[model samples]
Target: MLHLHILSWILAIILFFAAYQNFSDRQGPSQYFKPLHMVLRVFLLLTLISGGVVFFQTMGGGMAAQYGIKFLLGLITIGLMEMTLAKKKKKKPSRTFFYLVIFFALLTIGMGIWLPMGPISAMFN
Candidate 1:
């Protein structure tokens, strides 16, 4: 389940970059942008659901607070990604949102890796 959650978010990140590239085309948003964006949303949904499952399963442990913080950061990262893309599509200023997405995504990823339940930590153990 954790692996699935990780995979989904990684795919979501890739799809985000792909969609962003399509949006940055010289001719403006490419035809692929809509489809890519929709798929990205689906992956994000999967990520959320899987994260929820993991969160609940990890309850009764002392790490609940860390998990909660990671979950909230993940949500913020997703929200920022959506805002950045939407603002870009609408020709609005989105540079701040874009940077926020990057920052939050990295922060969330660091939290995930630092957590005891993830593959990275498991490997080290």
Candidate 2:
């Protein structure tokens, strides 16, 4: 469980950096962006799975509801990120998709803070 928590934080950090790179115009289609995007996807998936495990192991009923919401939001954010990446080389990234990623990422981070001491606690509090 502790290992999972550590991995989640590490993965989140990596994903955040990758997202920043993508947003900063430092990455592109044929360059480092694609691989970074793939890594972010894998890391996000791992984070979600580890979080689910922690939630189920510790909180069973309504306590787990928060985790479910966070998980769904994470999935939506991942989808928006995927769409953004798919549109590489376009004149501009979709502002709607970009905003969705930012919103959901912040929401997930907030939930990580507000929730109990789980894998994400280290990230926010």
Candidate 3:
């Protein structure tokens, strides 16, 4: 379950960057990026659900600081991604918004990798 959660989110993050790059290169998101966007959304859903499962199953009743921080950051990351995509769709892409996405993504990914001391981080540490 943890592996699924991590894999899904990592894939989602990669897709997000691809789509964001496409948006940055073009004035707006084209049909080319539409499929990627949809897939990205699906991956995001999977990520959230899996994360929830892991949280409930492993974390028990306590919400540790790392857990809360990761959860909040995950939501913020989703919001930023959606906002950036929406803005691109509306033909009013905000560079600042995308920049925020980049920042949050890097931080969230770092925390995700660093906070987990189980199998997820075992490979690295």
Candidate with top TM-score is 1
Model 1, TM vs. native: 0.94
TM-score of 2: 0.67
Per-candidate Cα RMSD to the true structure, in Å, reads 1.3, 4.2, 2.7
Q: What does the lDDT read for residue 85 in candidate 1?
A: 90
Give the per-residue lDDT of model 1 (tens digit) for 10-116: 99999998988787624679889999999999999999999999988888799999999999999999998899899889877778987888899999999999999
How displaced is residue 89 in candidate 2, in Å?
5.3
Winner of 2 and 3 under lDDT = 3
lDDT of 1: 0.91
In candidate 1, position 26 carries an lDDT of 44
Better of 1 and 2 by TM-score: 1
* Candidate order, lDDT descending: 1, 3, 2
Can you write out model 2's per-residue Cα lDDT over 1-125, one digit (the tens) per residue? 64775476467656645654554444444456667776777776777677667667756556677877876776776677667655544637566766777788788768866777544665776
User: In model 1, which runs have C-alpha deviations exceeding 4 angstroms?
Assistant: none
lDDT agreement of model 3 with the native:
0.80
